[model samples]
Target: MSVTAAEVLIDTLHDWGVDRIFGMPGDGINGIMEALRFRQDRIQFIQVRHEEAAAFMACAHAKYTGQLGVCLATSGPGGLHLLNGLYDAKLDGQPVLAITGMPFHDLIGTKTQQDVELDKVFMDVAVYNERVMGAAHIENIAHLACRTALSYRGVAHITFPVDLQDSEVSKPTTKRNVPNHTSDVFAIEAGFPSNRDLDLAAAVLNGGEKVVILAGRGALGASEELELLAERLGAPIVKALLGKGSVPDDSPYTTGTIGLLGTKPSQEVLEECDTLLIAGSSFPYIEFLPKPGQARGVQIDMDPMRIGLRYPIEVGLVGQCRKTLNALLPMVQQKEDRSFLEKTQKGMKVWWALMEARGTNQSTPMKPQVVAWELGKQLRNSAIVSSDSGTIATWWARQVPAKADQLHSVSGNLASMANGLPYAMAAQLAYPDRQCVAFVGDGGFSMLMAELATCVKYQLPVKVIIIKNNTLGMIKWEQMVFLGNPEYGCELHPINFALFAEACGAKGLTIDDPQHCAATLQEAFETPGPVIIEALVDPFEPPMPPKVTLDQAAKFAHSLAKGEPNRDKIALTVLSDKVRELI
Candidate 1:
């Protein structure tokens, strides 16, 4: 007697330390799902309404736990739906394994039902892509894909053909051999930064009138080292949104985030700095970048390819930031440019104060920041907060302080909308003892609202805060920025989210008054099961605080200040004092 391929795969997943999988069932994947059902106690298969939501859930699980997240999909469209969220995981360098269904090997070339090339569609976004053609290839391919996903720290795909899924295969008693990457292209000296690279970077810093530091997603892993580097150099640090909390905004060297939606200081520092040390981020906006040829740009990245991708580099050092920065710190000389760093830090402080002090008690519609900040204060230190892609995500990342025990997970690289609720459910389920909440926009909430049933069924305590503005806030803002007047098609109809949550077997509440936000949140948190609190937020809510580019403001004014245009009709005038003062 021989074990089936599906059973062997599930047993292997259990051995790989996977406690659960998020996926949807389909005819193509019936065999695999059935296998998963047999081990419901050892490895649970969490069925989600949409494959997109399932992928997002796996991403959150990986981010919170620092492990590989797994999601399954049926053939054709079901497999395709996983790409958007899987792309997010890949860009962020998260370890995610997407097991997708495909037509049997024989029918692949014939273009049978859902017979698209799954591996080909996924190759661009994943670290590795492989299809199991024969039962003999299962054990080796599965282990290889897993190792590749972990090694590259990104998404990997292993397509299981329907024909091969039920076929019997012998399981290896020991873990199979996994491939290793030994690229000389990325190799670095064993000791530290070469004397030459340090000499060049140090000379630039010593000679420059002002020095600034720009950190990106790559900086996430070496946050403490970055802080030390900033402190030693007395350079102001501005993180990309993805690099939120790389260092406390209050740190002496901190200067908030930089980009189109970035703070005034971040914009000003790039303009003023004679030397800019780029750390761990390939920030894409070329217009926001400083003069690469004349201005000194020193980059530190583990992947050599990313060093000079976005901007011209004066010194490109390939190594882990933590290790390389530690080695470079001693060899480099300190700068005495406290004036620039001081000015930038002071600007950030005043910006935050003005933003927070405004309309803490407005009578009309409540400020969005006020709601987010107040919720921030009420959240326990151990709570984990997830934000969907939108203005709300930016607000939470900026205003909500993540303490030692607290974790803040955002879809950075993929930066897609509607990930909040899915991430919230997964985070809460992963750490049931800790509180979990998702701050989502009206548009984002609806994207994954169907997952409410999954949360309720599992008895996972999670809270969802929906800013019901009834329109795509960020897109509306973009229209105001790029296009001259207000645009059509951005507006959306309002949803009775409270009714929807109740229908899904979870507690739901609606709050129109700003005064009751804290209390409403408290009651929701106290509820034993999942809860959704929909706040009919002001349509005229201010944009996320800090990091508004001068060009964006200028473009907006150029379009609107001419007259009370029709575009302004759709715009909400209930601006937050916090936002106005900061910009």
Candidate 2:
């Protein structure tokens, strides 16, 4: 009997070294789902509750492993649910392949049920988007999608009609697999910048007196080279959020994250630097970057389009991050004056002191900063931490100290909520032996709370720490800063997250008192199965920016006058802390 196209597609995926796929079964995808069942030993199918979680899991899998992550969904709404997670993959530059099953080819355009245009929907997010029209095209299309996703480091999508999936084909024509199991169609090499471009970049670095290095996700592979570059240039390094683990937070020359979710020391470094060296990061926030004419910049990126995109660049060197940095290091002159680096390091120490004071607060409703600080301290060097976006991100970015060997991931460019749980689930699935933890806010976690069952079903043993403030903490802060409005519609009715976890067959604990915060977290970490620690944090504790501008103060004051809850307590404590610095 001739093999079906669906079987051939699965075979191609297996040949390309794909171990697992995340998705749900549906009528539209029954053929492919059955094929997956038949090939259970070769490839595992992780059934998620929602298609969104499936895509999120796949995106996280790609991010954690640096390989092509695959996800599947049925037609119409199922495929639509994948947009947000697929967008996350696209923006973060992760290689992910999304396979969606569409309606029968004949009924696609007849206003049939579940007949959405998959190609049109996925075109923007995918580097390669195609629909398999014939049975023979399955292997070729599958191979191309995988290759495109891996080589380009972005999303590739293939939509298969349900009827065509089971269509039989004889002797599918494709390239022969080599002895090493790599396909001839997918072999590629890394590209680097020209020698002239490297020399120019080195010259720019050597000529500047106050140099600051901005590292991004692209620098993850070149930690040693990055350290050497910073040492030689006497430069202070400020990491972008995605670059959290690119360098150890304990490094003398390293300042914390720089942006809205950044530290004062990093902001200071950005303000004072005369020359900026950006490696492997295209952080989109221009407001956080130096103004025009503030600094001469040299950007190192593999994509020429992203170089000098956020800042004005004097030199843009297009090359692989590790290779480019290695080449530039030898040509660059070592700085004689280490004053700037020393000053930044001193400022970093003061910032750490301030954070320590905040993290140890003994307020009635526990401060969220303490959770991040305690968790960071307790995390092993081999631990993998996934943080959700919003107010929770501020704590992780500021308080959590990431080591070189440890891994950290957040929703970077997309900055979407509800990713923490899925990210943690995928990380745990990928590295079952490693300690995995997720820091998620109440609002964000509620968005995908159903996935808790996904964790328990697999017995992933992922530790979930929910900062339950019963409010959209980040949005409330934003309203105060931008609209001068008392937070409206941001409040959430408190739910017993601990009880919810227990209902899902997981151990749950609640830490409302500051005294037991540390002990409770330690217990949760030690639990053998999936655990959820619901820390009822103080909602009034705002995620203040590194520098509070005059306009921000005015808006905050207006918000207070408009009867923001806990105004007196928040103003007296947080505002007073800011005022003491002025004195």
Candidate 3:
């Protein structure tokens, strides 16, 4: 049977195993939408309010399911609106395909009403960008875009001209097929020396009295193997922020996350370890890594470039971490020494106990540490939480413990602000049965506040809890630490978030006192559909269970003694333990 370009487009997606396409229909893509009606059961279409939200949801779907998420849009302004979310997908390294409609071929450069070069605009963000000029090029170009996105695990764009999509094919076309199986061709081409490197890495871990294994999100599917290796070698595992709870937090080998916002136990333990093994973690900050000369380091990663990208690696293995670890397990001997492991565990226990003690006290500004702890208790095993990059992120990293089957989705590598709302939108779309909550700061929420309308329109039941501190708390802390005073940028104007939520047709709640915060959160969670709970916390309130610091304490004293106080008169002395111990 002769086929139209629109029919072939949907058919190609079905062949590629795309189960869902999140988008709204428009004039240019009406033909494609009509073609999708026949196969509604096999590939469902999720209609969203705006193209931006659709793209965000598509990106989240890919992250959760590890599939190539799909989104569609009309030409010009419609395609332009999708850029923010596409940028988010590209930065997060999620595999996605954005199919955009274009103006007629005859009017290519004649400056039509909505004419814009979508391919060139998207080139910088996506890994691959192409325009299907004719029906002859559709089959090959479509397959290439899909395969490139899947192989590279990044965004790919394909634009179809409106006239071309509606035109009938003159000649017969063959259906395109992409090979399902992926090979380790990257490793082979890179010429990674296997036998000798494995032997050397095995020897170093075996010989060292103290060894640490740090993993990241790249190690998602290999959590079990990681735990087994850690247990066998008596080496505890430290996770990157994204890798939190990759293994059950209660597991014996699980220490915590390592970074600037890292827990005291993780920082202290990593600092003391003599040998470090980095498995699939491409953490950006080199300072958080063990000093190059001090620790004997070995890195195992799927991407060859990431192996030695940041910290210097004594040995680099370019393969999946699980595969490389499987090969090395038999070559290495199990260590019987539990001295270092036991010591690290003891330190973690002590830190947790101290945090718990300090967090329980009732105070104004509602300690994020305590609030996050309470929220963690309320969290179900299936709850998926996403946090923005700020003081709120620090609270989530330190206080909220990880549970099995639970995932914390975030826009990493980019460290992008205003990601919490979009992430929650995607998580809700991906896992409809499970509860998805976004812990957003007021500043971060303001970035993409319009998404609330998207949530209401789709009836996605995502709970958004605003940590309303009325200031940019993280930047304020940075000012106190570096410039020796609070800066003008740290101040924030009060927002009526509950009223805003009401205007968007979503349930809303506001809590002023610390005592009512937990119950308010509980009510928000239980409310019918999409709900936003704004906890009006103290703007000048101290950070929850402040970090152990001597420099902070000295700065506090100097500011207090100044005739004209250089800093906010907030009592940070409550964070200090003993005078000499913290430094």
Candidate 4:
């Protein structure tokens, strides 16, 4: 049987256990699309509304499933569209393979339609990028792309020229047809740090009176070890937003997330800690971390580059979180002083109380935190919750009381908007039995609302909660806080997202009144197919920082005095918080 390059590549992926590929089709990928049709039984092709959504879905697939995520796109413009989402994967460290088509090999430098230099275009976002020469080149490129992406936990790209897609392999014929050069078998072992290195880390952790452990996305599978380490060391575990699921919110020791969209207790603990043990986290906010020399540090990470990248750590233990911690446990000594842990625990109680007060507040325009808080209550134990970048992220970070079994993620480093829907869709696809929710702001939802049809088409039961504030809420507040400028160009024209969802043939529900927030969210979660819950939360609800600085206070005052719009509402909202005791 004479096999075309496209078929060869597709078949190889199927052997590698690739069940699906997210993409939208076009003429440039005609041969590849035909190849997919032949192998559709083995590898399902998920059609997305946009190429950007395809890449985002691929990234989310990897995050949720712990497998290789693959997205396909046509030549030129379609490939360009995938860049934003691919960069999201690159920045957040997900394994993804992006296959893009080129116009034709001979069409190069001819300025033909969709004649893109795609390999070069993807160089910045992809760790391993190469262009396929012909049918004989398929195995080499496909194997390398898949392997590199998994090994590096980053993006890999392969560009196949339209002309060569259907070409049958020619006999070696003096060409460099290096055959059987690779195999599908690849494994990333949970390596162990040397006993000597573990001793060094244990000594650092044991010596300090007040120790703090910051867990990031890298710490996802090390929860048992983490709880044990914290118990022995008498340290409180503070999670970064990406690491929210490392230890559930109900775990007495976790001080929640720490940054702008963080808890006050997390901030206080980080500032006061005498020793810091970083477990698979590279939290970027240097200001919120302990002053460089104040806290002696010990960090555990698989990537040595990230171990001491954020803090001046004396010990850098390079290994997987669970494995490294397992090895280090024996050498670690119990710390008798429980004062710091007790203080942080007490602080957590006050923080949650404040969060509860903020979350339950009912007003004409419903509180946004109420939606997140109630959504937290409604989420299935085995659910996946995704948030977009904006004030919605703040609510998700602070209000979503996580269960140990639930998975929570946001667009971490890239902080991209319009990612919630795609992320939820991918999560739903990955695990159809478990629930998936998208917590999106109005501005963010508006950008990718068309994916509502994609959800319906795929029969993915994703609950989308749209915080319907008629403004670009985060940027508007940023203008007031950082620049001390009056809010301008932030207002969004109203769109009844629920009505739009109904029009899209999906279930549509709305909660304009505060009284109906809980019941409406419950209904949304319980509904059968894709449901969009338009929650009319207060646009004036401020996205406050974990701790306010004097400069920030002055800037906010200057903005208000200079006639920031909705000044009266802002004043009432600011003055109304009675949860002021802890700070």
Candidate 5:
């Protein structure tokens, strides 16, 4: 009997080093499911509650393992559900392969059930998207899809028609074109900028008196080179959220995060610098970046198009981060005056002091900052942390210190919620021995909490730290910041997440009092299996921006006058420090 297309595809994936696939079984994918059953020992199929979670797990798996993550879904809604998580991978620049089952080849254009045009649906998110037309196309398509995902460092997709999946390849085609699984077929090389561009970038850096280095995720491989360049130039390094682990947080010249979820010291460094040297970060939010003409900009990015897109560039160096930095380091001159670096370092000390004050506050309901800070201190060196988007992100971004060998991730460009749990689960699955934690808000956790059962089923010891504030904390704060609008539709009904976790067959703990914070967290971490620590955090604790402007203050006053709850608390915590600075 001839090998079916599904079997060939599965063999190709196994050859490509895909040990696992995350998805749910459906009639549309029966052929693939059967193939999985036959290849059970070779490739494991991780069943997830939702296809969205599967996509998220794949994205996180790719991020944590530095390998192409694979996910599958049946046709129609199931395939559509993968878009958000695929976008997360696309935006965050993780390599992922998404396989979707389609209706029978003859029924594709007809009004058959579960028949949807998947190529169009995934076109926006995928770097390479195609549909397999015949059994002869299976091996080549699979190879190309996997290769595209890995080489381009983005999402690649393949839609297999149900009829084609079960079809057998002709003997001649099968014999002439045997599947090849050699590692050399998937090898990719690092990119480097030309000498001319490197010279220009160096000249720009040497001309500036006060240089500020902004590192992004692209700079992860060049930490030593970045540190050397920063030290020689007397530049303060500020990290983009995705770039948090590129350099250790404790570096003498490292300013934490920059932007809305950033530190005042980072903002100060950007504001005072005469030159901005951005490395591998396509950080959006141009308002938070140095204003046009405020500083001469030198941007280093692998993509030539992204070099000057974010900020006006005096020099745009297009190459791999480490290679580019290595080349540019020799061309630039060492700075004689280290005053700007000294001043930024001093400002960082003050910013950290203020953060410690907030974290140690002995308030009634525990402050989220305190929880995050304590968690940071208790984390093992090999820990991987995944943060959900929202107020919890602020705590994770600012409170948690990035250390060497530690991994930190969030739904960066997409800023989607509910990704924390799936991300942590993937990290735990990828590195079973290392500690994995997900910091999620009450609102975000409710979106995909069903995945806790997946964690239980797999016995993945991923700890969840849910900041149960019973509110959409970030939206509530945004309403006050943007429109001075009073909180509306932002409140969430209180949930006993601990009970929910217990129901899902995982360990659970609820901390309502401030004193129980550490003990409960420690207990949850010690649990043998999946655990959830639902800390009822103070809802009134504001996620203040690095620099509060007069306009922001006016909006806050308007929100207070409009009878927003916790006005007094906001005034005490957020405004008091500003008031002190003014006085």
Candidate 6:
């Protein structure tokens, strides 16, 4: 049988170390599907309900595994569905490849049926994007796409015309006109920073009495060294959401996550610190960081572009972070004064205590924090967790204790909804033995609820927890706090998610009563197959900030006065939660 271009493309991907792909099939991409079927033993094909979920799975697979994640979709609408998830990968800097089918070559640009110009569509999301001209073009572009995706730490897209996909042609090579990256898979290794730059960073870190370290996704795999650095400098670490695994919450050094989904200790430390050492985090929100020139800054990043972009740094060290930290440890001086560390640790104690109280309290409608806190309390230390965006994200950030062995991530830069379940599914596939949990809001989960079938079919055994507040809780709060507007168009019609899960041939559990919350979560997590735990939580409970600004307070009050829905309930819930901390 003559070899097709699609087969050749799959072969190249196999050679590049791709083990599996996530996507659904369509008529436009039947050629690629046949190729995947032909070599089913070599590569696993994970079928999903939506192209968007497939893209999310791929992006998250890359994030959790550090491998090139690939998603396949058909042309036109299928291709269009991939943009949101692809954007998540691009913004969060995950290495992903999105392959889509296009209309026949002759039919393209005629505005023929399903003739969406995919090349133009992918321009913004991909670091490397190209369409295969013919069979001969497959091997070269496949190699280039995977290489570029890994190198840039971003998205790559390849569109193949349906007609040329099944055509037979000889491989083209050794021609001068052929592009340069035609060789086998090659690695671009990162080196350590120069001795001078390391010394400069160490000097700034050691000179300050009140120093704080901020770690992001790039700082993974340096837990021990980072802790040592923290001890040496008496600094507490504020982890960005993606880097939650960088340091253990069990350690005295961690102040939890930053930004709105952040801790009071992190807020206080950033506000009062005299020197800052940022590692691998371009944690936006400069307002939350130390004021410029109020503190000396040092940064460590592999990407030179990200090092000094978020903050003004006196010293920027670019290199492999673990190697960089090891080299600089010797140069840094240990501080005998542990006053700052003591104070930070004290604040963390109170924060945890407050979180525990909220988790244990019995409410008419379950509190969102109770769901996250109960889940975290029961999950295995090695378990992985994915948090979807919203007030649920806030609860997850505050209540979940990120152990060093646990992996946690969300749509970091993009902050997109519906990523939690997809990310958890990817995690379950990656670590079949270890449990994976998706802490998702009702609004986010409803957006991609069909993927529950993906979990059942694949037998992924992921534990999905839905905080069912029946509202777009985050947007309602944002409208109140940021715009001083009454909540409008934020409510969602309730769905019985537990019943939906049962209908999908998976285990389902419901916990509307706080009294049985822990037992229900334990039952859901302990079930053998895929399970969804739907907890009906209070929509009125606010995601209270660590520090409320006068402007924010004014805006929130104005919103309530302007007849925000359930304003009295909102005020009482907010006040009670805040008051719990002092007690």
> In candidate 2, residue 460 scores what lDDT?
92
What lDDT is reached at residue 308 by model 1? 81
Write down the TM-score for model 1. Answer: 0.89
Clashes of 3: 1
> lDDT tens digits, residues 218-249, model 2?
88878898889999999999999999988999
Off by over 4 Å in 4: 173-176, 578-583
lDDT of 3 by residue, 333-428 (tens): 788888888888898887677656544536665666667777788888989898887888877777778887888866677766677877787788
Give the residue spans of candidate 5 off by over 4 A: 172-187, 565-583
lDDT of 1: 0.77
lDDT of 6 by residue, 154-269 (tens): 89999999988898855454474364348864566566788889888888887899999999998998999899999999999999988888998899999999888898999999
Segments in model 1 whose C-alpha atoms lie over 4 Å from true places = 171-209, 359-361, 544-583
Clashing residue pairs, candidate 1? 261-547, 262-547, 262-548, 263-547, 355-578, 540-572
As a whole number from 0 to 100, the lDDT of residue 474 in candidate 5 is: 94
> Once model 2 is optimally superposed onto the true structure by TM-score, how far is the C-alpha of residue 224 displaced, in angstroms?
1.1
| Candidate models: Cα lDDT each | 0.77, 0.90, 0.76, 0.89, 0.89, 0.90
TM accuracy, model 5: 0.96
Tens digits of lDDT, candidate 5, 358-423: 677666767898898888888999899999999999999999898888999999999999999999
> What lDDT tens digits, residue by residue, belong to model 4 across residues 402-461?
798998888888899999999999999889899999999999988888999999998999
Question: Arrange candidates by TM-score, highest first: which order?
Answer: 4, 6, 2, 5, 1, 3
Clash list (residue pairs), candidate 4:
none
Please tell me which model should have the higher TM-score, number 3 or number 4: 4
For model 2, which pairs clash?
Answer: none
